[model samples]
Target: MLIFWKPRLALLAVPKTGTTALENALASSADAAIVNPPGLKHCTVRKYRRDLSGFFEQKGKRPLSLVAVMREPVDWLGSWYRYRGRDALAGQENSTAGMTFDAFVQAYLQDNPPACAKVGSQAAFLEGGVDHLFRYDRPSDLIDFLRDRLGQPVEVGRANVSPDGDLTLSRQTRAALETGRGADFELWSAL
Candidate 1:
């Protein structure tokens, strides 16, 4: 997450949405940057509103506007699947090493997903607290918004990309995900 005090803006780091690259690019100019301890780095909108919003308003005399990015729900799940399948996580309980993308996504749609498919929903992360939302597939739009707000160009390169592979979900699995994660699909569609 990156905060620009002058702009009274906070960029919430939605996972797998190229936030790392944005954080890296804006760190020098940001009034503050939270980039360690995954919990803090990926603080959700609810947490920020509950914990930091009051502090910012008290100290800065105004509330910070929040910005976040959302990826297409299925692609987001695919990234999680591919990420956990990396060699580094092989044999770990959280590893998706031998699992097919369809299996991984089916696990994700479970009421209680296993570690490998427990990736949180973007809609849940940004629920009710975003002043601006960007589509993950549209980098230029985000960059342009940042430039306008910060009075400087904002550049972000890809970071933390999941391993490359073709990920095809079975029709049944896709239908289940769409039904089970309706909020995610709705939010992404609205974006």
Candidate 2:
């Protein structure tokens, strides 16, 4: 997460959604940059609301506007599948080295996902809420908002990007994902 005290904003980092690029682009202007300890780096809306919001609001003398970018559910899962399949994690328990995209997704949709597919959903992460939300595939609105508020051009170049690959899921697995994660679909559609 990156905080801009001037504008009273908190840019929530939603994993696999191009937030790293945003963090890199705006780091110089941010008052605080939490880029390590994955849990804090990807602090959820609930945690922010419960633990950090009051401090920012009282100390900064302004309520922070929270913002986040969310990716399409299937594409989000596909990114995770491809990310865990990297050669660097070949032997790890969280590796998806030999799994197909369909299998990876099937694992993710299970009642209790295996390590490789244990990523929490975007809907759950942003459950407490955000003042501004943007889509990963289309970020012009977010860019404009940041530019206007920060008084600097926002250029988000790729950072921590996933490897390129075609992703395909079986009809049955897709159906299961939709059934199990209806909230994600609903949230994305509303966005």
Candidate 3:
């Protein structure tokens, strides 16, 4: 859950990667702080990255060492789709809940939907602008990496909600996301 990291640590919350659970655990167990953005529903890297240094300066906190969790694009998008699909159908009893796989893939690549707003283009994330990247699928390594960076031990287990549904992607969708979104996939692979 929570591990001290350097002086100021920013968990660049990439969405749908168990971020809420991780954030909850950290807030409860450690001296973790949340960025309080005025009049905004949520924070995105795009909203804050360019302005981060000043934000830190205003808070009288040093520049933070950043960490983020990434998931394999295929699995990540699969979970995203399922979660969104459920929400899309939440109030409608007989709605066609979600797009076809191909449509989802197209929208995922071309639209860059708001649901994934904070996640930037793969090239940017892969270029190491952040201090470290961790795999969401393999959280133990993420915890260990943070521990090493923080020079402290961290407990990296347990969750408030059991991840509700198993994620599944059609083979065609997987192949396309891997081939077309290879950069994002590779970023996680490198970590």
Candidate 4:
């Protein structure tokens, strides 16, 4: 997460949404940057509302406007599938090695998904809503927001990209995901 004190803006780092690149690009300008401990780096809206919001209000003498980025649900899951498929997690329970994208997404639609497919819902992360939200597919919108808010030229490159592959889901699995994760689809569609 990156906090720009002067702008009174807090950028919430939603996972797999190119936040690392944003952090790297804006770290020097941010009043505070939390880039360590994955949990803190990817602090969600709920956590911010419950914890950091009051703190920021006290410290900054005003409520901070929260901003976040979200990706399409299926592509987000595909990133998780490919990420866990990397050789580094080969034998781990969280590894998606040898699994098809369809199987990975099916696991994700489960009431209780296994570690490999338990990437949290973006809608849940931003359930409280934010002052600004950007779609990952349209990064230029985010860049424009950052440039205007920060009063500086902001540039972000791709970071933490998962393995490359054709991640096609089976028709049945796709249907299940769409039905099971309706909130995610709705949120993405609204964005």
lDDT of 2 by residue, 70-176 (tens): 99999999899889888899999999888889989889988899999999999999997899999888889889999998888899888887777668888898999
Question: What lDDT score belongs to each candidate, Candidate 1 first?
Answer: 0.89, 0.90, 0.56, 0.90
**Model 1: CA > 4 A from native:** none
Candidate 3 per-residue lDDT, tens place, 83-184, comes to: 555554554532224455355555566644434222344444434456777777778887777566655666644542322444455677678767877788
Query: Model 3 — TM-score against the truth?
Result: 0.67
Q: Measure candidate 3: CA RMSD.
A: 4.9
Residue 111, candidate 2: Cα error in Å is: 1.3
In angstroms, how far off is 55's CA in candidate 4?
1.3
lDDT of 2: 0.90
Tens-digit lDDT track for model 4 on 1-191? 99998888999999988998899899999999999899888899999888887887785568889999999999988888889999999999999999999988888878898988888899899998999999999999999999998999998987889988679887888889889889989999998
Q: Write the per-residue lDDT of candidate 1 for residues 24-139, one digit (tens) a residue.
A: 89999998899998998999999988888787666557878999999999888888888899999999989999899998998888889899888989889988759999998988
List RMSD in Å for every model shown. 1.2, 1.2, 4.9, 1.2
lDDT of 1 at 22: 95
